[model samples]
Target chain A: MDLLRFITAGSVDDGKSTLIGRLLYDSKSILADQLAALEKQSKNKEDGEIDLALLTDGLRAEREQGITIDVAYKYFSTPRRKFIIADAPGHIQYTRNMVTGASNASLIIILVDARNGVVEQTRRHSIIASLLNIPHVVVAINKMDLVDYSQDRYNNIVIDYAEIARTLGLKDVTYLPISALKGDNIVEKSTSIPWYEGPALLELLETVQLEKDIDLERGRLGVQYVIRPQSNDLDLHDYRGYAGKIASGIYRKGDKITVLPAGLTSRIKTIEVGGKEVDEAFAPQSVVVQLEDDIDISRGDLLVNGDHLPQVEQEFEVLLCWMDTKTLAAGNKYLVQLGSRTVRGLVKEIEYKVDVNTLERQPAPAQVGLNDIVKATIRTATPLPFDRYTDLSVGGGVILIDETSYVTVGACMVQ
Target chain B: MSKEHNYQLDYLDQLESEAIHILREVAGQFERPALLFSGGKDSITLVHLALKAFRPGKFPFPLVHIDTGHNFPEALDFRDALADSIGEKLIVRKVEDTIQKRQLTEPGGKFASRNALQTFTLLDTIEEFGFDACIGGARRDEEKARAKERIFSVRDEFGGWDPKRQRPELWNIYNGRIRKGENVRAFPISNWTELDIWNYIRREKIDLPSIYFSHDREVIDFEGQWVAVSPFIRLDATDVVETRRVRYRTVGDMTCTAAVESSASGIDDIIREITATRTSERGETRIDDKVSEAAMEDRKKNGYF
Candidate 1:
């Protein structure tokens, strides 16, 4: 079976944790001991009913506050696919946590309360899904039981969200109506909503098309580390290999390649995956490639097919997400790490900050604080090969680390 | 999609590649790194991945083990043999020596566990070598607190983990940058579950310690779980020691780690047993975590790996 990584975003009032708990419970992923523990904790509730939301609130503070503070990863598998859920908090202040969770997700499940259809929280989450370039979107309208399982309510919500989808330029959006608390339209088709003809949430998750997400056209590999035995043995003497995971596309033995920044050309002599020689290697596969000629390739160097080379420049524009408590201003210097390369970078200028809730480009702020997303220009000390975040996320996403504190302060997506 | 263009990988391959990538990041970023080895199935799987990651070349870091002295003889024997077979450097530090030097008080109970004291020796070892990063076999599916941990979890100089201060880990990029005195605990297999590890082991044909398989042992029943009767625990007169065919699901200090009654003698049987089991890996085997709901989280905040 294959794997699917997704994120669930909704505020505490929208039943985000309840949806995840229901997914695990209905899929039989929760064991007997875990259920017993949940039952014990549910006694403290006012209603004396089992609170499934207790499953994802792992931290003590989160349990006390009855809210998700940070992103917690949960795992479950079915016959066809293995699922990794990044359950992130949806409060306004927790936008950074949501971005961190949505960065690696191929799909996103945005929960919208049926009582309040297409509210501000829903728009904010959709904006993030678009910013991170999530391929699939599942807008689960939760709490249909409260709405009396009315088909008209579901249709109105879908119509309201279609406008937001268009304004944000979100593609491949899917809508579903369900009651996460009452177990309606989750694992099994609900008899209550007979007018709805769509499959259950579990079936849609299993059958989502993800193979097209992997780009096999432009092969890219960033050299993470070089392996050299340098031993005196006759068979092992003078062996060197460039080791990294293919950022995108496919590579084969005898293929002509070029090392970026230096623009050195060579032919692939051999390809090894898991220490075994393979004829060809594709995207996302970690392999060791040996060049026919001895070239001075080191870490931070990019290798790509000779035909399609990424842009190598020292200056670029990016949408920066400030993550640290310290404010960021123009002329601030930090370490920018893109893929395997880390270089000195300066925030040249802050053009404008995008209002997440309204999707409007506001005036440039003098200083950007935590959870602020801004469009800015950055200049690196050395030329680096990179693609746009919209085109190839693996090569374009970067993180900024503080010089003295050594903390990751910002996440930048190349525009 | 075309027939020859079937570029999809099995779940195992995807997990393996991701792990190797993280391992390589540690090698590329840290000036001095070490792999925390405990002679368990998870760490053994890590060793296998390390071999695949840096074969035909020596590993960038040595294998370090903080011996709690309360370990089973079988696991210690296997630890020595595995390091010897790989022809790599293995550094062993004893918690017994730390307790003696520091004059620390040991917990007194029927099951006196040294699991908590392993952190002191680990911190001392880190200081002695100035290791900038230590790769472990911790998986998120094992516990709730671990599920929120990052792949490159940054620790303070005293080796404390602050969950709220975790760096934003995006895509496959990991930030291994830390201050001089601080170190990172890198978990390459953070995404792998217990079932994933077993399936990977079965596919790779990786050899493990004999305790992982079924064998006849004298065990004591504690709170509906089977605890091995070893010299580390206090045996009372009222306690009944019976011979039962059992195997360990997790390897830790002999006093804290429990065993399950099973007849799974091979990898296939163990996989089948785990598939049909109702309890989690930690729920079934780890007795130390039953102290409270946030037991693991509390320990992790105080520098317990």
Candidate 2:
């Protein structure tokens, strides 16, 4: 079985927690002791109907206020695959949390209440999903039982979302109708919605084609550490291995490679994955590579196949998401970290901010506040090798860190 | 190499790769780091992963253990033996020494657990060594509060965790940058579940202490749980101690970590039993977590691992 990481985005009243709870409940992932605790807590509430939302509200303040503040991760597995759910809060102020959750998700489930067909919150979530370039999208029209499982309502909502998807250029979009409160169309097919001919939510999650999502032609590896064992043994005198995770594509023994920024050339002498020597290694695999030529390589240096070298420049454009409380302005200096490299960077200019609700580009703002997405130009102190975020997320995504406070302040997708 | 080769990794492989990446980050970012080892299955699995992560070269960080003095003898022996066999540095700091040196009052109860006192010794060790990061084996699947924590959790000078002030972690890029006197608690295996750990251990053929397997031991019944009859706990007049075949699901201070009645003698049997069990790992074994609803959360806020 493989693993799939996903995120669920919706408003507080859209039954996002209930849907997650139902999926875990129907899949038998909730154990007896946990259920007993939930039952006991449910009794203290007014509804007293085994509030599944209690399972995801982890923080004490969240439980008291009946709102999710930060991103909470949930896990469940089936015979075919295992899943990691990033249950992020759905509030205008909490967009940073959603962006943080969506940064690593392979798929996204945007919940739309059947009673309210299409709203600004739905549009905002779709825009964020589009901005993050999530590989798959599932528009779950929830609360169908409350609407008497009306096929027409589902169709209308799907039609509305299709227009938004087209505007945002979302790919691999899927639609489904379900009632989380009544456990319909979650783990198993809902007999009530016979007109909707699609696999259940769990089935789609299990069988989603994720193999094609990986870019195998452009291999990239950022050297995080160098493994050198200068031991007294006969075979360990002069071993220098560049250690890193294959960001994309594959590396084989004897393959011609280049160390970026420095522009040094070398041939792959050997590849080892998990300490076991292998002939070839692919993306997402943490491996150690030895070069035939002795080169000065260290952390923050990029290694790639010579044929598919990334852009090497000192300045680039990025879509920056402000996550810090302090406003982001032009000429602000911060540490820009891409892959394993950290360099001093300056925000040269802010072109405009994208209205998350409507995909329109607003005029350049004097200052960018928290949760604002803006297109900006950044100039690094040193040249770096990177790919466009739309092409290779692992190599292109960068985080801006506050130099004095030592906090991550912004997330930038290299343009 | 063929261009059409299948590139999909197994679930365990993916988890392993992710963990290795995190470990390498710790090695690359922190100036002074240490791996928190407790000789439990989780920490043991972490040691195994560290081997895979830094083999052919010495581990950049040492294996550090916070000895609670209430630990089982079997686990302590195993911890020393494993460290010795691997030829790694092991630094041990005792909570007993901290309690005596600091003149702290111990909790009074039938099961007087030193689990909370562990934080004091751990913080003291961090200060003593000037460690900028502590790599732990905490998994999000173990508790609700842990589920909300980030892979690179930052703590103040007092070792306090403020949930509201947590920085947003995006993508695989972790910000290990911290001010002086502040340290980060990095969890490499934050996403693995209990069953996943067992499956990985079985596939990797890792060795464990004999206490993980079924054995005859003297245990006392306490609130529908089985507590081992060790010198750390007080025996009452009504308390009856009996011999029962049991195995531990989690390994902690013997005064607090309970045992479950089981006859599973091998990893396969243990995996099968865990698959069929209804109770959660901490719910079945950890007596300390039963104190209140936000037990783990409160402990984490005050700097408990």
What are the RMSD figures for all models against the true structure? 1.2, 1.1
Report the CAPRI category for model 1.
high
User: Tens-digit lDDT track for model 2 on B237-279?
Assistant: 9999999999999999999999999999999999999999999
Off by over 4 Å in 2: A43-48, B1-4
Residue pairs with backbone atoms closer than 3 Å in model 2 (clashes) = none
Estimate, for each residue in A2-110, the C-alpha lDDT of model 2 and write its tens digit. 9999999986699999999999999999999999988888744555568999999899998888889999999999999999999999898999999999999999999
- Candidate-wise lDDT, in order: 0.93, 0.93
Residue range A130-184, candidate 1, lDDT tens digits: 9999999999999999999988999999999999999888999999999998888
Per-residue lDDT of model 1, residues B99-136, tens digit only: 99888789889999988889999999999998999999
DockQ of 2: 0.88
Query: What's the distance in Å from true for residue B219, model 2?
Result: 0.3
Instruction: Show the colliding residue pairs in model 1.
Output: none
